[model samples]
Target: MMYRNPAILTRLALLVPLGLVTGAPAAAQEAVSVEIVPGAVSLAVGEEVTLTARVLDAEGNAVDAQVLFFPSFADGRSGSARQSIDVDRATGRIRAVKGGEFLISAIVATARNLRGEAMVSVAFPPVDRIDVTPLGGSTYVGVATRHRATLLDTAEDERDGEIRWSTSDGGVATVDRFGILTAHAPGSVVLRAEAEGISADVAYEIRENPAARLTDEILWRQKEQFSDGVGYSWIDSLKEMAEGEIGDGQLARAAARFPTNTPLTKEAYLYRSIFASHFPGEPAVRCAPEGPSIACSTPAAIAWDPAFAGMADPSGRAVQGVHAHSY
Candidate 1:
């Protein structure tokens, strides 16, 4: 009584296009997957990174959708990515935010046709926002050097806000007008930058003074002569010292440099001592020898001005050099 021959009585037929009645076409299926192309590691907090999202159909044809990505873990930090657009639809490229693993999502919806979704993950590195720079890297001693200290947001600070500055060698160099530092001597210095009391330092190396070098020929060229200890002026040599030590071989160098009349020579050494003490112009402190000078003992007695407090020997005795015989 069970269907003993139901299979023999029934007939099955294929439904196909009228032209191809022997076969049928397969139905479409869904193909939605997410992938992140290339890896992202560290990045400056305010820097940019190129990100992409892709879509495809089960048949291997390219699919279109709205593409956008953001950091999965912002850690409560403020960050942003470029707006989602069809550019990914056209070129498949976009930029992402600052930090953490990014969750890239893409959504596509059609009016009852098809829908697609995708997600990709990427990590963003941190960035430093502060920046500082100096102006006119080179300078001469006794001349002012100017510098501009700056702190920038790296992302903003379009207003060009105020910047604070300080230096290690303020005495040797000072900042003014526009953070300009006038150099004093051959040495190194530092400029410290601070904003709201937070600070950073940069190195500045000042080299030895070239113009300060003392030379004989150049002195001669300048036609500089001694002022006889009366006043300070540019001179070739000891117009003031040569006369005082007259033939004093110990002062041979100063003598040759200045080689002057008696009165002028004695007075020059006096001037030399006073110049050294009062003004910081001369590089050396004292040049006169420890013993009595020939001018003191010879008839060619100098004005013997006590005004040059430390010019003579500690004993106060006056002797002379080879030129003493002339007196």
Candidate 2:
């Protein structure tokens, strides 16, 4: 919709078009008046608004002519030279480049000259501040947490803008574009959310996860169960039990014994302990009792020789009714 101001109409009456004489000869010529539709405008920076100028003869009849639009700052600086406003010389369409008030003129030159000017106020919605939710918190490795970023404009209105998320140390934690943070290792990292030129930062810490560690070790052992490698099918079952079936205290106890540096030996021991604790005296290995002593064999030892049995005790006595197995 177009809006015109009565005060601006009163000012336009005195300001005649340049090169048009106010003498009797010029008065005899058709008097043309330029009416700037929508005498006032308001828009945000980088926004576009259309301004139309109506050229009328002395009889108020529409007259078609070549119209040129000129834009200038309120301080009398050339807006075109400063690149603050873009004018489609062909059409009177105007686009604001920055935030400021500008005076736009629509001028026409022919046998008679006509001119009209209007005011345009371009504003910029500045970001006053940025806020990040869950300010600072802790999470476990292999866990994910959702974060939120809010932008407050100068008007104190909340605006949802496109945000870019980043982490100070990607090795410790990573954040997606949506601000979902995934912890990768045990460390602290600064999570940053940026929109426009404003940014907000929050500290996030990742703690070691015993269950995840144990599960990773068990998976590694499972991958080694190929070809002639020692089979560790029980490790998979132990992982499921530790995750949900077993009690937290029991799982924690088993996880405490997990090796940090040398994983293979420690993982094997941990699995065996879990298996033994759950099913005690369940004959982990089969043995043959020969006279007063028992001959025990494991899957690995049996592969070497069918008649092979376990070694004797340190006291040089026959291992009586005792069986042993190797993982």
Candidate 3:
């Protein structure tokens, strides 16, 4: 004999002809229930989540049945009708199309109409791109500039997020975590900003200040003044050469005559005169040209002069009338 409740019979009568209710042994026909795995979920727009429904008999045993999944908004309207949720009926995959809360249901059609549901809350989309400002420019050493990083969403709207800033060469330039750049030396460095797996870079150059160059020139001039027998006139000439007052070739010839190993003194003018005669240029000082050896020196004479020559002069110009002085 089949024990039946009037309410269940009425439900079965209303559902049976639709092929939604299946007939089976009384034990197998007991009231059924559904349990949805992962009772709740959270996702972002354009993100997907998988849901599963398990049907159980009244005795708490698992059973197989054809299940269908659907979604509804908080207002009790169909989510699909509102175009906010997409469902794969065969696989029970739910994709969020917009930012909203939804109730997703897995239903097993039967005499008892067993069903289970999960609540899904979809958040706003994450940032897809990062934009950094002051892209390419130069800064003077020891100067600072403020930079900015803007985060943009898929729709090109500005969004808010944490950003990280860095520089490729810390010695040339440095950026703080908040994107403040400071130039430390003369060179180029790449600045970068990162947010939500997206990154942007800007190339920057740091240059020496004009005042810094002037200071370096002053220090070099001071060092030259301490040399023995190197008069203020010679130092002034070197300063003029550095300032482009003298031509490159002339300056090079003048530098060739300076004593290297020997202390600069009056006798140093002899080597200067010898170099001037062979190179056809006037020396810083005039020397008598007619003496033993014609008072003009050979390239080897300058190269072997223990007081003047520390290294050989590559130019092998030979001079005949040369004299060496001991003063």
Candidate 4:
């Protein structure tokens, strides 16, 4: 039963067993009597509460009583599901059926002697929902494909970042303590995020990157830096091409700014395979002129079959280039 001070029941769960006699001492005994210390009551749907029972002789010494709780949901609510658990000798747990009133009860027996029953009402909480953000694209092979999600209250208000994210795809991806995802291999993964009892989920794919260190370095160096009186964005250092928006002269100077930055390389045929997997209507060319090997695609047109979409970067325009097809 629910109690005003819960610790008193917790202590009782542990101590109730101390008074029972087992094995050698009980062979010659008469029938033991059992009675539930806590009594019965009504509860709101989905409420959780605790129960405890005691077995004793007519003289009032605690005896060994085996407790067994039966399902007795309210008349029409019998269809609701309930689960009960024993935490210790004197205490057990019970959850009420959902969405309606519930009648909960418990029983115990000392040897073959049946004990009395007891219960109390608990109110079940409400249903809730959550929304998860996309953790798309491959982060070099063997890393988590993660999605960020925000929690929502029952009223649909966004709760602060008090979220717990998990996954069902242990073989494909693993989640870290801070909700960062790591791909375990080249395959699909499903991720889940939850708060309180509410939950939501999404799925994505991941693969290994043969050029992981190099890719990481490029992504890392792109962070803002002050090379001189002029501050540079890491993208300003890559190969540049003229877009409809930016002129070739400006693109050339931006490309010149970081002549020292290394070019991203194709490590394996697998790289081509992944790039080719882009969806239809993706941009095919970005860093260069509309060419054969663009990574992204423009929305209004579909160009080459192998080319998905053009990838745009801050780097200046030079000669047009293509990223190879995915393996």
Best by lDDT: 3
Off by over 4 Å in 3: 1-122, 211-327
- Report the number of clashing residue pairs per model: 24, 0, 7, 44
Distance from true location, Cα of 296 in model 4, Å = 35
Q: Kindly indicate the candidate among 1 and 2 with the higher TM-score.
A: 2
lDDT of 3 by residue, 1-327 (tens): 989899988998999887777776344545378888888999887889899888788877878787888788856753252377788876789888766688888887653356888888878666878888877688899888899999987756577789998899999998888799999999999999998899999998788977676775576542311321354455445434444543444445544654332212223343444555776533433343422111134444554545435322211111212211111
Name the lDDT of candidate 4. 0.49
What is the alpha-carbon RMSD of candidate 3 to the true structure?
A: 24.4
Q: How many backbone clashes does candidate 3 have?
A: 7
- Give the candidate order by descending lDDT: 3, 2, 4, 1
* Candidate 1 regions with alpha-carbon error over 4 angstroms: 1-130, 135-139, 154-159, 214-327
Please say which candidate is ahead in lDDT: 2 or 3: 3
Model 2 agreement with the true structure over 1-327: per-residue lDDT tens digits: 889998987666656555343444544435378888899999886789888988778898777776778788877753252376777765889887766678888888663347888899878568878899989788889988899899987756576689999999999999998899999999999999999899999997789987865665576442221221333344445445545654555544543543231112223345456555765553541231121111223334434533334431111112322222232
lDDT of each: 0.45, 0.66, 0.67, 0.49
In model 2, what lDDT does residue 254 have? 48
* Model 3, position 131: C-alpha lDDT score: 84
